[model samples]
Target chain A: MVIERASVTANELIAEGIFQMNVSAPKIAGENPSPGQFINISVIDSWFHPLRRPMSIAGREGESLKIIYKIFGAGTRLLSEFPVGSFIDLLGPLGNTFELTEGATPVLVGGGVGLAPILWFDETLRSNGIDHTTIIGARHSGEHFLEHCPKEGFILTTDDGTVGIKGTVLPTIESICLEMENPKLFACGPEPMLKAVKQFAEKETVLCELSVESYMGCATGICQGCAIEHKSSSISEHSYHERFSLVCLDGPIYNAKDIRFP
Target chain B: MSCNLTVEIAGVSFKNPIFVASGTFGYGLETQELTDSSSLGAVITKSITRHPREGNPPPRIVETPSGMINSIGLANMGVERYIDTVIPRIDEIGTAVITNIAGFSIDDYLYVMEKLEACKAPICGYEINISCPNVEAGRMEFAVDPELTGRLTESLREVTKKLLIIKLSPNVTGIASIALAAEQAGADAVSAINTVFGMSIDTQSRSPYVQTNVGGLSGPAVRPVGIACVYKISRKVNIPIIGIGGITSANDAVEYILAGASVVQVGTANYKNADTARSMIDELELYLAENGIENLSELTGGVIPNE
Candidate 1:
């Protein structure tokens, strides 16, 4: 992990309230970051915005990395206002990455801003000459981020019927799971969608890895702020401290079987 | 202009007067890759208990306007594992290490102290944590009650000749008396003002943001409260005062020194920038040089009030 002062090369809105920012972060980008790792960004160095917002790396090319974020709070709103050529402090590429199995049919699912890591994973698989299925979900057609996604082998779904499929990504995921052998699910999204995916993966006995999201402090595991509950009472092999899995250290990526959601 | 940043706390001399507060810099090894830890005067490890604790459930922390509330609940690897894993590697850090010990009972604290004292890891001292508000066992009772604080310090004081510093909380009516009690009972120093009790609500859910309902608040928002506590405690205790709470830069550290702290620990600021405390050593030297002060200690309680 490293702290780099990355300059914003581009920041553009791709969908409703969603933005894609490209930064010139040689230090972090040079680390060969895998999917599911993230960069903690500090927009303003003031008490008003004390903690850095953790944004997953959507894509990376040489010395440049891409981050997709939604303008949900003051921290992100300030991030959206940073003009090109401005500098932002980055602490990353932190957290563990998604594990890809050799010969396992990959099924990638993403919802809302959680699509960042999935898109990166999709591109990684494609580059490796691996065939995979991709699903992107948003509330409606206007909220979908398709510009950054590949044109082929992608399924677009929206809650409303204004998009390709008028439902969540679960149905498409189920169909892919049924058709493929040794299918491995890689997913990121809201809690509800993840829980649904977890249930489906467990019933079908498919391997599943999830990229989690949480409000973090120190992103380096010093603060012990970002915590998620694990399934086991005894410490799992993945846990560093105890029962709660630190999202920053042990994961921002976890196997769905190891974590429990309410 | 030359200045000395060295400070002597309880007979242990530190290269500089800046130390990373406990709990903020986990074990001091977690950030070695991101920042240089050896340059720090001292590294205070997170509070270690007699047994391993799982801590509270998820949603353990939340950011406020200019601060954050954390209810980590003292989740630690226990004293035995800490000594086994972290102590043997202490020399690698190339700086003094002070293990912060926390427990539910007097024996619990003594157990940790004895274990640490018997070790040969060159630990600087012990920072007795009696101010954790997240746990239900004591609920910071030792910090609020002077008698309990005196007893806890006196018991641990008997077990070791090393530096004994009692961490104090700000959620009390008489913080000075607590510091005085620890001093009278043989505490070598007192680190004033752990997090102030605070809470934040999520409007959409209309409930507490942290799972523990209320946690300790630390950041720039609590700097004045910490400075006031240090000043009040400095008046009653003869031992050195180590100030901690929301210190980000040399200016904030200087404020604590002027208010009566012999040294300052970077707390919430470490979360934002782990290098803040280490960098403050240079900044502090520059501060003393520019102000025509030859020694950094000369600024302790230097604040002048208009009568």
Candidate 2:
């Protein structure tokens, strides 16, 4: 990972409280970044705060990168207020990337703000000439981010029934898997939604990988801030060789079977 | 005008007087992509014990407004595996090394030391970590009393002829007495002020945030505690002091040095900026140059005492 000052080319409101920022960073744009890798962004002119906000790479457009940030706290709120053509500090592309598999039908599922990273994953699958299915959900109608997404072969769900199906993503997940011949599961969302997807994939004997949204510190693995418990015998196979792994280092992306949920 | 930022402690010279504090930098392998480890004065490895520890449960770290509290519980890959696997990686970095040793008992420490002695890794010194706040063992207990601190330092003194620097805990009544004890027991230098004791509770969950109920607090919030400790301990012992607390910039380092710390360690600030130590080193040089000072040693103990 390298630290670079990225200039904001476009910062627009895609949804309420959620802003899509397109930045021109040669250092980040120069790398072959996969889905699920993130950038740790610092609020401009805010030195009192001692932590950076971790924003996932929404998509990549030639020499520019896209990040969808939610106005959660002071740091992010300040970040949303920055005018276009301003330089912002970003330490990226930090963390491990998602493994793209061939010959298997890539199934992209996400809920709420977790759909941010899935957007990039969708772009990658399409650019590789791979046929895929996209499943998305959010809290309500206006909260969903479906901008510029392909309309065909898409399933939409929401909690309040204002958009599509009046249910959670878990119930719709099973029927979607049954229709596909060779389904590969990839999901990112709330904790309960991720757990549901993991169980569905395991029960159906399908491969599943999850991008967890755990709180982070350095995003570089030193702070040990984003640690999650894992099944002891799971991650020992890889070079990580640890019982517990940092979300920033070992993964923001983990195989569904490898981690032990609390 | 030459700005001399290097410092010599216990016959070992450091490139600068800033180090990435233990627990912040994990064995120097984790942050290699972010910053060059060799740029700092000396790299201190995370606390290594005899056996592998899995550390604490989930929610290990929580960040407050100004600082953070961590209860990692000294989880590490045992000394044998460390000397076998980790040492080779650290040895490749072209910088001086100091292995921070943390154990529950004296033998646990001695066993780690004995194993390290046989290893060919070029570890420059051993910073005796008798003051880790996250563990529920006798490690922090050793620094609470002067006699215990003295005996532990003296025992390790018999084991290795290498440089020995005792790191002090801030959760003590008389920190000066503990420093004096370590110095009298043949310690080469002392690291003043480990993390102070603290805890946080989640109001919505109605339970402790960290599994251990309490943890070590670091960052700018703990800087005052560290400055006071360095001021008190410097008068009691003549050993060089490595001040570690909430050092973020050159100004924080100046406060510690003026308070009689020979050098300083950057801890919690590293979480936000991976190269806090390296940046602080450059800032120190700039400060020296701006003040028309040639030697960095002139800042140490420059604070005036009110008569």
Off by more than 4 A, model 2? A44-47, A147-151, A234-241, B89-91, B132-140
Each model's TM-score, in the order given?
0.97, 0.93
Q: Relative to the true structure, how large is the alpha-carbon lDDT of every model?
A: 0.88, 0.82
Clashes of 1: 0
lDDT of 1 by residue, A1-262 (tens): 8889999999999889999999999999788899899999988977677899999999999999999999988899999999999999998899999998888988999999999999999899889878888899898999985742435778888888587777888887898789898999999999999999999999999999999999898998888889898777677443346568889998999999999884
Worst 10 residues of 1 chain A by lDDT: A233-242
lDDT of 1: 0.88
Highest DockQ against the true fold, candidate: 1
Candidate 2 lDDT over B102-188, as tens digits, reads 987778788899899878567888998896422444335888988878888999999888889999999989999999999999999
TM-score of 2: 0.93
Candidate 1: segments with Cα more than 4 A from true spot: A147-151, A233-240, B132-140
